[model samples]
Each structure stands twice: as structure tokens, then as C-alpha cells.
Target: MVSSVNNPAIAMAEKPPSLEKEPMADVEVGIAVTDEKDDRPGEGFGEVSDLKRGLKQRHIQMIALAGTIGTGLFLSSGKAIARGGPVGTVIAYTVVGLLVSTIVFAIAELSALVPLSGGIIRPAEYFFDPALGFAQGWNTTYATAMLLPSEMVACAVIIRYWTEQVNNAVWITILGFLLLVSNMFFVGVYGELEFICAILKILLVVGSVIMGIVVDLGGGPKGHRLGFQYWKNPGPFVQYLGISGSWGQFLGFWRVMGSAVYSFSNVENISVAAAETENPRRNIPKAAKRVFVRVLLFYITSMFVVSLVVASNDPGLSKSAGDASASPFVLAASSSGIHVVPSIINAVVLTSAWSAGNSAMLGGSRVLYGLAREGHAPKIFTRTSRFGIPYVAVLSIGLFMVLGYMTLEDSASTVFDWFQDLVSAATYVHWIIIAIVYLRFYYGCKKQNISRDELPWKSPFQPYATWVALVSFTILLLTGGYTVFLHGEWDAETFVSNYFNIPLIFALYFGYKVFRKTKMVSLEEMPIRRFIEIYQDNPEPPEEPKKGWRKLNILW
Candidate 1:
């Protein structure tokens, strides 16, 4: 018997052990029927997780802010402009941003209620099916494992801007070591580091936007008041692939969708560490509700500013330097005769790369730990140190950081790029899975006669928002490599990278089902009411009123 002090749900005397043990059974369909008469708090959907809750509300907010602002925004937004013109780029970002907002809300609702690790994966098992949970869990872990080396390689590339005398392998080694060490500490340490990096990134983006506006108004030494001149000349859209008229413009706009998705890849990471968060029911929702604002200020507005100062036709935007030279902000400043901008942008982008790697390490390890807890992964990954750090999982994921050395070789570097593309496609599939799981959670609540208001927190724009995101992301996934299908444009790498993950996910799902015979969790058996009882029994303390300086710290 479990103590009520540790878990209030176990205090219910009338509850049967079968209700608690069934969902975790491996061989047969586990049906967890809630006892309507026994209103006492029930044990949460699963076993009591052991991960420590060291992340505060501020840490949650900062992680959400910093996680998504990485190389995609700092370096690849330029590629978006070159592929799609200013108008097209902005539109694609806005559309994807809105859709991504829905995803954030969907996950937030589930995370607030479940408050578990593994982002949507844990909830996927409870609300959808164990097979889906197994599939997406591994998919996320694989993508995040690949992400570490990719970001480390980007760091090595950025360092070359300062001095190529040092071997790329040296920088890769240094960055990988720092990331591994950082994730091995307590969760607070990682949160504090990300908090500081997020502030720096926010400052750089705000400063760049202000600088862009000044340059557009002829405030720079160039003295050319460039008010929307690029828009007029490039004519709002590019004629992609030498095609003419609206069709070409449409293709260009469609192409930007992938880049936009990549730019916003990890925005939903706010809840990935839900079990390690303080007052998660409140903080996760707080961080999630602000996603649209962050998307507008950091992404859409910055892309709009880039459009004003940098022309879509600028050759610099197409440069393959893979450093600050390829950033549109750097291009704008250089064109305006501001020489110091390259070093400044390079410096911040380097930190962004490192920060991204650190985030990947944390997210990957936690997902692996969650898999272990669910019996999907080896039990060794479940080991944790005295600090409540999953050191074994962290070490396992850190081993992949060695992949950064692949960049030292020419042919291996090309292979690394293919892996990066595969990760990008996998990101879309992850979002699609989130939507599916949330929809199931939504209908499960309805099927069991649970009210949205009864949840710990409810996200606005319910079933409609999720439905739209589902259809749109599905279309984007199918057409991700459409160019390869066109005449005279058959690149095996692009075709494979874009479409390979589809079959791979299906195989994982079916393989797990065939081996384990796990069935789709029926709505009636979902532990929604049990989870609600836990939420009601264990109430988090109300936030204290802010006074003076504390009130001013609203950035979180």
C-alpha cells in the first residue's frame, strides 16, 4: 500500500488494485474503470514518477522561449526569403505559427492534466494506444539524439568565422563535452543556463529588429531609405524554378512551409519535462498560453523586418558559408557598411547552437527515461543519481554526441546533412502525433462525460483547432519533397529524407502491436476521472502576489 502523503490517490480505501495494475499490463488489453462512488483521489494514471521537480515557473517560461530560437531562426530564415519572397515567407510563417500555437495549447492541456515526462508520449499511451506511445517515444528520442551532433557541428562551423587555424574536430569536442557535463547536473542548473541564454537571444532579436527598422529608414551610413523597395522589385513573390505567374508564386510559398516548420520545430518542448517542473499544473499552462506572443514577436515580426531591409534576390542570402555570413541580418548590416555586425551575430548564433544542443540532451534523456518507466526501453535507463538526475539516460544519449566528429570528414559531413533532413521530417510527424493524441484525449473526456472545466487547465479553441492542424500538417508531410517528384528533378537524398520516416513510424507501431498485442485504449477505460480526482485532492499552492521588482520581472 502507498502512503497518502506521497500519493493521495492511493488513500482511497474502496479502490481495487486491478484498476491501478491493468493499464500497465503487457499481454492483454488493460481496462481501468473509474469508481464513480469512490470520489477519493486515485493514484495517477501510472506509477508515481521519481524525477525531482526542480524547475520553477520562471525556468519553464525561459525554456519555452529559448528552445525554439536556434539555427533555424538565426541562419535558415534567410533561406526562407530566398525560396519565397518577402510576402510569401511572412505568410507561410504566420500560417505555420498559428497551427503550431494550436499544438502548444493541445499539449499544454494534456500536460497540465497528466503532468508527466516524455512530452506527449506518456499521454499518448494513456489516451490513445500503447503502440502509438512506443512509436513516437522512439521517434522523438532518435530525432533528439541526432539533433545534438547537428548543433555541435553548427557550432564548429560558426567558430570557423573567428579562426580556421583550429581544427573543426577540436571545437566539436569542446562543445560536446560542455553539453554532456551540463545535462549531468541537477535540472535547475540546466534551467538556469538556458534562462541566461534565452535572455541573450531575446536581446539580440530585439536589437536586430530595431536595427532593421533603422536601416530601412536610412539611419545607417548607407543613407538609402529603402521603404519596401525590395517588395516592389521582387514583386511580392518569386517565380520558382523558372516557372511564371501565380502558379510559380504558389509553389514558392508552398516551399517555405517546410522551412517554417523547421524554424518552429521544438516550440512544444515546454512540457517535455513536466514531471520535473514545480507547480506544473500552473506553470506549464502559463508558459504555453504565451506561445503565440513569442511566435509573433520573435519569428513573424523578425522575418517581416528582414524582408524590409534584405532583398529576396540578394546573392548573399544564397551563400553556403554555413556561418554568420549566411544570416540575413548580417547581410543587411554588411550592405549598410556596418562591419561589426558579423562578429556579433556569429557570437550569439554560436551560443544558440550550444543552447540547442543542451536542450536536445535534456529532452532526449528524459524521453528515454520515460520509455524505461513504461517498459518500452531497458530498465538501465531508469537509474537516477542522488540529485534525481537520470545520469544513465543522459550518458546513453551523450554517446551520440560523437557523431559531431563526422563533420571532420567531407563525405561523412554529407551523410550528416541527410540525417539532419530526416530529423526535420520527423519533427512534422511528431506534431501530427501530438494532434492525434490530443484529439483522442479530447474525445475520451467526452466519451466518459468529463467536462473541460474540470481539467486542471483547459486550452481554448478546442476540437476545431486540433482538426485544422491535423489536416494542414498531413498535407505538408505528404508534399514535403514534391520537388523531387517533378520532371528533371529526381534527387534520391531529398526524396528519401522527406518520405522515409513515414514507413519507419508505421513499422514501429505495427511491430510493437504484433509483439505485445497492445490494443487501442478505449475511451471508457481512460483514467480521466481518476486523474481529475488526483488534481482535486492535491492542490498546488496559489502564486504569491508580486511586489515591486518582482512585478517588473514579467518577461518569464
Candidate 2:
């Protein structure tokens, strides 16, 4: 709809007379030609354009699929089951799935209407408060940077299941190089890479479920009919931290929430790539709607199947392997005397970790680029190459990939635990901020006498879903580390990992707020009417109708 001023942090001072008469083809998407510039607090950077729109509809769809499946599902699953028990684990994941899907739906409505590049961070600033966006942008950047190393470490650790002969450093170095090289290319290459990886993950989940069902039905090499047999033995619930009965089972279920959230961490990432995607207003909504189904099929169903096929008390589920070898799928296959399945799962999990690393790099770098465009970060981060890759931001994030080497010193499982705690908390904070931002935008519309039905896409349940998810996520975040308070269970690492992000986010938000002297804008000043005009002016091109099988994309 507009040029560089898409980010209200940096408003346009003047528009060229020709802009009103120019056709869409004659104008560049975000490259402003006017000499006039706004002198706002964050507006010193010259006219800035968006990253190239190289990712297509298929790329977006597969990325959406891939983001929902990661090391959290593949490796940490056994841990979740071990802690939460089979039944408790399933229930925890199901509840979290509902909460996360609600957040996704709310974001879909916001992004489809505005279609900005920074995802939640952009909306936070535009409609709520600029300080909130500053905090969220960096929180996302930091969390994603941390996740990159975590994924890289996961890849390296998975390699160890094959052989300990090679040093972990060697695997980390080689894979880190691949990760950097992959991001250095055009954005479409990254899209294609993720598409292929997503397909492999999907196939892995499907094949594992089928194998699990067969094994449970006494169709495997060993004729064992495990029709909820593990449920009977393990008794369907774990007593975590020596707490007995219902309370322990509840704690067990609660522990799984962090892991489940981690598993679904990046599902909201489709919007992070909005600026680089074609027809984002149309494609993003399509991608977002599919995120719910992908989460259900890949995460919910996989957890149920894994819990059924493997007993939570199995000794082989031990964390000694520190990798996917401990995954419930591998444990079940190995226990059933199907030795080959472990290696197959090992390979697929390796790709899943690497795919997640690539996706994190892209998402983190884009957020940094967006931050720079908004004058929240140094302008150097906005520098792009001829092919439109943000080289500076990529290199900045790539430097943190070295954190993967920490696995060489500590056990991979231990390192993974640390990353998981930090990331899970950060994920909660980010989601909480999303709820706040969405509520502000929603109420701002009502306050401005704007109609929700007039928006490009509107989610059901309105402000009610927003409030439910907001309260639920806040409660989850506060209690994420409840176990640390048990009589003998006081762990500094665990406490810091779970709660550090709360204060950190607060500091970042208020630190920016005080330094910038930014005040929360009232609904009247949110510019809701102006943004609606922008959306109306830049209506997305009509999407080409899908062909025969292409229509099945909705089933993701």
C-alpha cells in the first residue's frame, strides 16, 4: 500500500506528486523515490526496501509444516513421556496445542490485515507501543539466535548416535558451514531446502505412526500385542519429583507443557518471512490456517502414537545417548527387534535439526533487518547484497552458531536442557506480548468505530480467545519451573533457565521505554483508520486457482 513508511516508527514526511498517478508496475514495492524524509526518533536511515519476494506458495506451505516439527518432537519426546507419563504427556500437548493454535489464529487475523514483515513485533509497535516492539524484536532475535546453536548442537549430537569416533566439534564445524552457506544464497534456495526437509519430516512421522500401529497390533517381528499395555504397566501417569498421586501426575503433565511449547515453537514463524513471500496477504493466511492442522497431525498424533508404542519406564529411553536415539520411535523399534529403524530415524532427525537451524537463521536475521529499518538497531543490519540477502544480519547471527560447540564439553543432553529452558520461557514471553498487542489492535478498531468484518481475514471468538490464551500463557510461564521448589529439588540452572526471560523482557521493554521517552499511545492515536486504508489500497493480486491435487494443500 505504501513505500518505506510501512513501518510507522519511521513515517513519511512528504509524498511525490507522481506517486498518486503512477501505476503499480511503474513503482518499486518499498523503495521510496522521494527526497523528503521523516525525522522521528528512529527515522534517520534512508529509504529502505524489503527483502526480495522469492519464497512461493509451496515454500510457505512446507515451511509452515517444517516449523511445527523439530528436535523437540524427535529427541526430547522421550524425556517428556518419561517425566509426564504417556497419558499425561498426551494431555499436556493437547492443551498446549489448543492454546498455541489460538495464538496462531489471532496472529493470522493481524498479519493478514497489515501483512508487515516483522510479524508480532511490527504489530506491537504500530498499534500498541513502540517500546513493546523494541523488546519483542530483540527477544525474538535473541531467542532465535539461541535456538540456532541449539539446533546445530542437536544435529551434532544426533551424529554421535551413529558413532563416537568422530569428535563432536568436527560434526559441528561441517554442519555449521552448511548452515551458513545455505543462508548466504538467495531466499528461495532456503525455501526449497526447507521444503525438502519438511517432506522428509512428514514422511518420518507418517512412517513411524504406521510402524507404531503395526508393532502395537503384534504385526512386527516380535508378535507383541501392546494394546495400551504400557498404559497399564506405567499406570498412565508419572509421579515427578517424588510427589505421589494426583499432584505428581499434574506436575508431570505440567512439565510437558514447556517441552510441548518448545515443539511448537516456530509454528508462528510463517509471518516472520512475510516480507520475503509473494502475495503475503493471501499466502500468509493460507499458511497460518494450515499451521493448526500440521500441529495436530505431526505433533498431537505423533505423541499419542509414541506414547502407545513405548513404555515410559523403558530403560533404553535414558538420556545417556543425548540424541534422537532416545526418541520414543527409536526405542520402540529397537525394543521390537527392528534394528534398522533407529538409523533411519537418526538420519531424519539430523535433517530436522538442521532444517530448524536454517529456519531460525532466516527468521532471526529478518527480525534484525526489520529492527534496523525501524531504527531500533544499528543501520548496518539493514545492508543487503545484490540478491537481497541481509548479509550483515546473517553474519551477526551466524557468529552465534559457534555456541553449538559447547556440547563437546557438557553432555549434549545437558546443553539441550539449558537451551530448552531459556527458549521455552522466551517463547512464553513472546506469546504473551503477542496477546497484548492483538488485544490493543482489536480494541483500537472498536474504539475507532471500525468493523472487524471489513478486515482481510477475521478469526472467530474475537477478544475472548485472545483473553483466554493470554491468561493461560501467563500462568504457564509463571509456573514453568514449579518443580524446582520441591523439598530436595532446588536447581539454580533450572530456576534461571525457566524464569530469567521474564525479568529480561521487562528490562528490555522499560529500558527502551525510558531511554526513548516513549509513552503508550491511546486508541485514538493508533492510526487504525490509516492502516485500513493502506490495506485497502494495496489489495493482494488474485491468487491463481489451485489445480487438482494442489487443492489438498489445505490438509497439511
Best by lDDT: 1
Query: TM-score for model 2?
Result: 0.92
For model 1 the local lDDT of residue 271 reads 88
| Poorest stretch of ten by lDDT in candidate 1 | 25-34
lDDT of 2 at 405: 75
**Tens-digit lDDT track for model 1 on 482-556?**
888888989999999889889989999999878876667667666677667667655677888888888888677
RMSD of each: 5.2, 5.0
Task: State each model's CA lDDT, in order.
Answer: 0.82, 0.78
